[model samples]
Target chain A: MTVLGWTRHRTNLPSGVRSLHCGDWTILVSDDPSIQTARHRLAAQVSCFDAGLDFLPTAPAQNIAIYDATSFTRTTDLDALWRKLSDRGQFSVAVRMAADQEHRTQDGRSWLKTRQAQRQRQRHCGTMLADIVAHLKLPTTQPRHTENSASCDVLVQRDDTNRVHNAMQHLARLMQGPPDMRLCVTGLWPPFGFVDLTSKTEAAE
Target chain B: MSLALEMATPQDAIRSSDTALVDVVDGLLRHGVVIRGELWLTVADVDLVFLGLDLLLASPDKMRPEGITR
Candidate 1:
């Protein structure tokens, strides 16, 4: 499984490795227009989910996470773009997993502890989302109505029921807000970023 | 006079409930279009924990725990 796309941090790509993943998900960074167009169109296919108020589930049979720079440029401003693709977001996900799960080793203890601390800070922010929702009570909308940002989207295979459900719920919660702060879920998508790394690694050979 | 909890303090006048801090935090927590392929993008979400650290460092005078920075 692989996510073919572009990244702003192409400088960080590992030697002989164009894509990267921690588990069932893989990310590919690129700035190609054709790829970006395909990604944008994919977002259009799945228009029921929202970015800020929903939680995304796991990938389907074979999932991929693609990031294209051309698409990211067409959507958001500089600050928002940088923040959207920054390692900060990815890091948060990792830390969250560690905190939510109890898998820790002595050698990885320091990293684990630091991640836990970070998770606490982020949780503070996430918990406050309730206040933001109460104050704004934003409407739920499709991507067609709003301006695009990072062309944010997710695609899951038809059989990947668990992941699809999880992604939908997660995205829904994050999409909450007032009308001015509407959440944009493009449409149903094809699994592009969700993939089992171990499975793929074994297949690559 | 003490500051209202609802409102940020004078020193943090630039800070407001409407601030993008949390949004930024959320985006870092879970934003960006993800794809899987031979060309992969490995983003360490824990790296965003730095945002909290940055927040704490910026307001050391407040002397809050990493958790309270949010």
Candidate 2:
């Protein structure tokens, strides 16, 4: 029996290092020297494979791209990138915040500050999503369950390629939103969460 | 040809609105398939401090091995 699970573990990560994984690609953001070495090694490994290993593959099948959000200074910059990616096909993107002074000094006060920060982050995400939806001219209805809070995850279906491109463009624009935001994007594939291993095995036979 | 878009060099837009940054962070962290792992620090090849928190976001479907499903 194949069982699939998602696990989250928290560690005392060195300041400034944040990691985002999309599909088989992993993006680590940090100024830490050791972490930088790891990132370089990973990049080399991906290049060496040429076809990208099972997890991180090369273009055509899989394309792993990196961008420094700090450099993106305009909405146009984001729009151009979005158009480029949309011209392609499947993709996914993720954004994160740099671990700064407030994150480094974890104390009682910081805990409260973190909560406030989370609220602010959610609001920002909402604004970005709203902007994207408006740009794509898609329905702006909030998912029923998450009506109160911002819906962090935006799933773009591939039924119609044009619609998919609009969704992807909107997401790309979101990545260009803020300097502190660390973003990573990847091409989409079947989700492990909903896959049935037993059914797969039976089908193969 | 790489479809990857080249992010322009830092300019006025780099300093986007605070709300924008917050939203980016929220979406990146909150939405996605998160995988957690740990890193053990070594000093002079000697294993020392253990860093227990790390997250990697990806498609949840691809991360699962055959035997583990949740």
Candidate 3:
């Protein structure tokens, strides 16, 4: 199963380096003179095919992007740290994964009402759903199908709920949610977690 | 596209808020699906660093925001 994942670059990676899939997950490896040395360890006794980082999709629909801020020694306060990042034009990293999927629907109601309104408010949602269905209908479509030499699967992430009972509420929404024309959330998964900013080094090659 | 994506990008109105990043990462860990890979690293440092400490950063509050050079 092909999995999509991502991570943020905490420091300036060496020039010409990208990312790599260490195992089922993606990781960053150096592209220095001993490239093969790094490869030897990562590829050791592995049966899976390694999809180099250059091909990773930065787009949310295509990949699971991650944003980490725990390495900063500048501040211990989460709020202050976030503010510092924001002041310096780096705040976007935090929202990189869910930003595109979140919707703002105008309704005289609470969060639930706003979320419910998204289905009716956006014209493209239907179109997108149709496109997904069309993609799935392809005779070659399979959970592990590789199209254009790239793995394909139903990409889903959370942007619907953020309250105390987010899980239950989301599960409820999933149970009674509107019928999606073509997308399927369940199938083979690659876990997408191994992908980190370091993989970018592999892409540079 | 994932909704957390837009929230993570900085252009969103909520980007500047203190909890926006927290909320986005939280949403990702709780709802985001890593189609493949054994372990997904969501922390910025671990993703960039060649280490296996992502689990430690799962608690968003514990992660410190490192500055970007460019």
Candidate 4:
């Protein structure tokens, strides 16, 4: 059996889901090898978030993810926060992940020129990353990044949704990243970075 | 004696109002965790190949946007 992820209960199981009981959670598993089944479970996991149920997903990380109700913070407040700010009650604004990466052209006139252009775009993406870190007040060293590509997943504080969207979108366009990189302002998701895995570690001990 | 991959990036018109479409793609595809490690490929319950792999799941449109990159 291959493990997919952990959930607080056996509430929302997709096809082939095998629930393994844990001290405070259930491990969702599959009969297929981890590779084949993880993808199927991921698609199911994306669509659903219940107020009463909490889930921990996988990175081929397996179902043994040690989870307890206390280790994770609920962003259900995020939806309420977004609703108060914007009337978009169905959706929320705590987009946990923001990605910006170098842009490239499919075909170009010259290799030298394309390489130069690619590097320029990368610098812009790097700058955009720096801007995001500052905007969110995310604590990190090397406040500026000049890498060829960058991406991050972080918890957003409850600020105005439209403000962050507009600010990011504006700066992204000004930075002139690849179309998608310029355009990618993702939506609210489970707080992957914020959760603690002490339960998993304790289980191992 | 050469191979090439060419993909047209989507310049589709997306209003600021419909960030939902873009958001859905980002959350479902980009946000999904990737599996990276060594593996054994087997057939008929016998291991046939060794694989060192990093795997990500996404639709063609999302993965091929512009071109492939890490």
Candidate 5:
């Protein structure tokens, strides 16, 4: 199995890697896009019954998948991307969140404050990622995929059916909460076989 | 006239920093999967701005560069 890495600009491309733009994200696969795209577009969304089975086709060898969280707006968008990656046989997926410092103003005094705030935010993100991983029962010892100064990456494998299910379900629950709470799932894709259970509560409220 | 004084406890300190909750909130704000919805202002944004300012104010002494203690 090949290990996956994540970064802003593409790096260490393997021979025969094909770049694919999935929504706002970009990825490099080993096979041709025409074949992969048609296969994924035709595959129906796998339901809970077929949850454990890997319905999507495996990605060709030495494929690199990249997703940008800055422009992510929907959980389904992420799901589709994850499904595509999974289908291509890419077991490991890295989700990256752009650092807030990029949006800082140049004023030194204010910038200092923003940087401090951003650091605090980054630390918090690290801790929360820890919690989510724990909740999803994912392994904690996965190697770091890539290094980026402006963002943090959380690496998850696709093979663990139970862990993937837990992660997806936990994310769906988080999304059901108020908007502020919903931000935690911002860069993650909901797991396969996920259903929104909070809509009824919201509607009743 | 007399006034009663309350003593601070360890619990109070933990509650003040709220390290875990703060980290979770920070993570939610900074990362995770998001659902697209119609754009609108919500109390969360207002609260987050104030929370950031509060955190900034609380650690003003730590804001300075190393070796420059206020």
Candidate 6:
């Protein structure tokens, strides 16, 4: 069966949706063969149900826990974004970027191979990600789909359903990336980076 | 900060890099769900099909190069 998401409690679901009884969590499943259809269904349901908040959309491999969102009284954009997010049900945002790949240290600089440079850049990207995540004070997970430094996915979350644009703005301002790096703020995403999906079944296996 | 960053919907952010709409595909691929099946896709009137494709539909982080861990 194709799994949609896992929730702690069961709720009113539209027709064609079914559930799989798993430990403390309710695993939502469906017969829909279309993966795209499953995605749209999941995205639409996230805002409606608490269980839909954490799932996969190029989610990180690890299960990161979701955190309580802090009350925010920011500017007009954030306020508006929150309202829009509330209406649209956008819950998460991803910041993808390319890191600078250079080893300036004397010994490190000596080994300026292609792979070494790439590794250095990846390290820099990881460091930058940690710093940003720390400053935002939000839960985040590195997406497994991240192909390279150019497409690293850092899922940021907050207490409000998806009222994390201000954090995004702050993140954007703090990001002094290259001109070619384009920052796209996408939403209503599960902090798939934020919740541990490991259930008793996995442990039993 | 007075910097007006554009807001976009997920649909607009799908393929293009510079459009402002809300992007909601947090992870467009299914995480940890590998569909071992065939694929039929069309791009610009071109129909493409693949057999025996083990679809590890998730983040590229899953497709990390050998010896590299994120």
For each candidate, give the interface RMSD after superposing the true interface residues on Cα: 19.5, 14.6, 16.1, 15.5, 23.1, 11.9
| Model 1 alpha-carbon drift over 4 Å, by segment | A1-36, A40-106, A140-205, B1-70
DockQ of 3: 0.02
Question: Candidate 3's residue-wise lDDT over A1-205, tens digit each?
Answer: 1122222332343343444433232333333343222112122101111221222212122212122211211122323322322211111111011122434545333333433344243333333333433433322122221110112232222222133124322332333222231122221112222222322333456
Poorly placed runs, candidate 3 (over 4 Å): A1-15, A18-116, A122-127, A130-205, B1-70
Best by TM-score: 6
User: How well is each residue in A114-170 modelled by candidate 2, as lDDT tens digits?
Assistant: 544654665565565455445544322232111123333233333554565554554
Task: Return the TM-score for candidate 1, rounded to 2 decimals.
Answer: 0.20
Could you estimate the TM-score for every candidate?
0.20, 0.30, 0.20, 0.41, 0.28, 0.46
Show how many residue pairs clash in every candidate, following the order shown: 78, 26, 54, 0, 16, 25
What are the TM values for chain B, all candidates? 0.20, 0.25, 0.21, 0.26, 0.21, 0.27
Writing each residue's lDDT as its tens digit, candidate 4 over A78-155 gives 223322322111111221112323335454324334445545555665556666556655323222122234345434
Better of 2 and 3 by TM-score: 2
Identify the runs in model 5 with alpha carbons over 4 angstroms from their true place.
A1-106, A141-163, A171-205, B1-70
Docking class of 2: incorrect
The per-residue C-alpha lDDT of model 6 at residue A60 equals 26
Q: For residues A1-205, could you state the per-residue lDDT of candidate 6 as single tens digits?
A: 3344444446675455665554444555556555334334444344333433333221222211211011111111223333322222333333344443443445422433433445444545445555555675643544332323322234443355344666767766767654534345555444443333333333467
Cα TM-score of candidate 4: 0.41
Of the candidates numbered 1 and 4, which has the greater lDDT value? Answer: 4
lDDT of 1 by residue, B1-70 (tens): 1111121111121122442323222332232232211221235743322222221122231232211211
The positional error of residue A27 in candidate 1, measured at the CA in angstroms, is: 31
At residue B41, give the lDDT of candidate 2. 60
Whole-model lDDT per candidate: 0.28, 0.33, 0.26, 0.40, 0.30, 0.41
**Highest DockQ model number:** 6
lDDT of 6 by residue, B1-67 (tens): 2223344544444444542221234344334444444344547854443233555654454454221
Task: Give the distance in Å from residue A123's predicted Cα in candidate 5 to where it truly belongs.
Answer: 1.0
- The stretch of ten residues in a row with the least summed lDDT in candidate 1 chain A is A89-98
Candidate 3 chain B has its poorest 10 consecutive residues by lDDT at: B61-70
- For DockQ, candidate 4 versus 5, the one ahead is 4
